[model samples]
Target: MEYNPQSKQEPLDTESEDRFASEQPSEFQQPYQYQEMKQDFKHSGPGIASFVISMVTVLGYVIAFVVVGAMATSVFDQSGNLLASASEVIITIGISVLILSALNVIGVVVGIVGLALRNRRKVFGIIGTIINGVIVLLFMMLISTVFVNAGGL
Candidate 1:
């Protein structure tokens, strides 16, 4: 292709683009539909739901961590023998883990549904499913360790 000197060219607005992001929040800013990356596609609702549920599971995990931290000193005596309060830790961990696992299961189910949706973006669904699956696997490993320690190997 030959460059035609006579053809008119649109000037690039380099100054506007070079401005810092914080200095560019104006009502005149282009809406999403007008942006170059905007597409004729919608994100799946189920995918969003799954992602949200995955985030919620993190809260339960945090609670479990807090319980473990608060009770760490009592879980075992200085002699390394399991103490009476160890049972409390086990029960709390067990109950919280089960609840979190249930949430992960729900997230996975919703993510699957999102992936099956027509003409919808699958990024969130894939991400949520992978995160939830990994968490479930980690929980399984923890439970297996408990069994092993109990002489169930």
Candidate 2:
């Protein structure tokens, strides 16, 4: 009953210690649960790679269009005569398109693999796959139009 400021406090009772221990779960007791949580929180590298490739492909396409448009605009003369032949420009554009198409194919494949893994970053994979698919479809349509115009349809 005496108020002694310097006195050591009594140790916790056995019942109180047991209750406190029971309230907080030990990390080692449920390591498997934590392992699953860690796996769930892991970042998906393939998904991010696919998204970056898709974005780069889109940017390449835009640059190609700009370059080709500039060439087409400048290659013609004031009287619509050929200031410079367009065959070389056309060939260069064709080669660039082929390279971009190959990149889009790779992006789509990587995106599919990422989606199959079912990671938290699957959205990036899904978007990349969609963009690649659209580009492929557009390329196919362009090829079909060329065939039709050439009387090979």
Candidate 3:
């Protein structure tokens, strides 16, 4: 019902020093099993490689698109007529797509390898796999579209 400063006395042994007296040691040392477990878990190297590859592929796509967009403007005359040299833009796009496609393929392969590592952490592996797989699928679709259009199908 009311606050009392000296209501009850705390145990003298629990006054910080005596409380930790038995718990304290001459030096800090971890348990053997704990130390072993601490060193057991690590990030998979291939997983990191896969993630980096995917990130680079994404950046490459962005840069390629931006560059192509900039150059494409020059391919169109102000009167909406296509220039005779528009083939260069096509060639640039083809090369960019091929390179990005290859990068995604590598990322997917590396991510799969990472996932196969028995003791390593799998978060990056799974994420990289998914990202790379999606990009590869998109590239496949793009290639298919090109083939279809070229064939007049």
Candidate 4:
């Protein structure tokens, strides 16, 4: 093309192409679209459901511990065979389940805390997620043990 500076239109050459691609707006040209997303109880982040669920898990563990503690105290009352009696077995199983349940509750609490502090620190979020996973595993293990003890094995 011939030189046409006065034409008031620039040529679409390589330079213009590069400049166009490289150009960026000082701020976003379009505002960020704010959309409310539908969330499920399982998928919700550190929201009400998480808090409620964590508390529920903790409550469940506490209940189990209380029951086990009472049962353990009762076990010693029954005399005779000190090794393997129904009461002793019950106490042992109960204690084990209670411990696992407590750990699971702790994991849920950590996960909830992580979700709460996700905005402040990503590490907290990750830790919370890990804890939550651990809790789930613990719960699963607890269930499996119960089943095995119940003769489901």
Best by TM-score: 3
* Candidate 1 lDDT tens digits, 1-153: 243243257654677447545465677785456543425668899998988888889877997889788887777878899988788888888788898999999998999999999888888899888888888888889889988899954
Tens digits of per-residue lDDT, candidate 4, 1-153, equal 344354548557898658655664446575466765433113335443344444566566667667767766545534644443456657666676666566556656656665665324344345445545666787788788978899955
lDDT of 3 by residue, 52-136 (tens): 9999999999999999999999999999988998999989988998988898999999999999998788888998999999999
Encode model 2's per-residue lDDT on 73-137: one tens digit a residue. 87787898766587877887999999999998898898888778753657777888899878978
Q: How far is candidate 2 from the true structure (C-alpha RMSD, Å)?
A: 10.7
Alpha-carbon runs more than 4 Å astray in model 2: 1-40, 81-84, 118-120
Kindly report which residue pairs in candidate 4 clash with one another. none
Weakest 10 consecutive residues of candidate 3 by summed lDDT: 1-10
| Overall lDDT per candidate, in order of appearance | 0.82, 0.81, 0.86, 0.57
The lowest-lDDT stretch of 10 consecutive residues in candidate 1 is 1-10
Error of 2 at 107 (Å): 0.7
Worst 10 residues of 4 by lDDT: 40-49
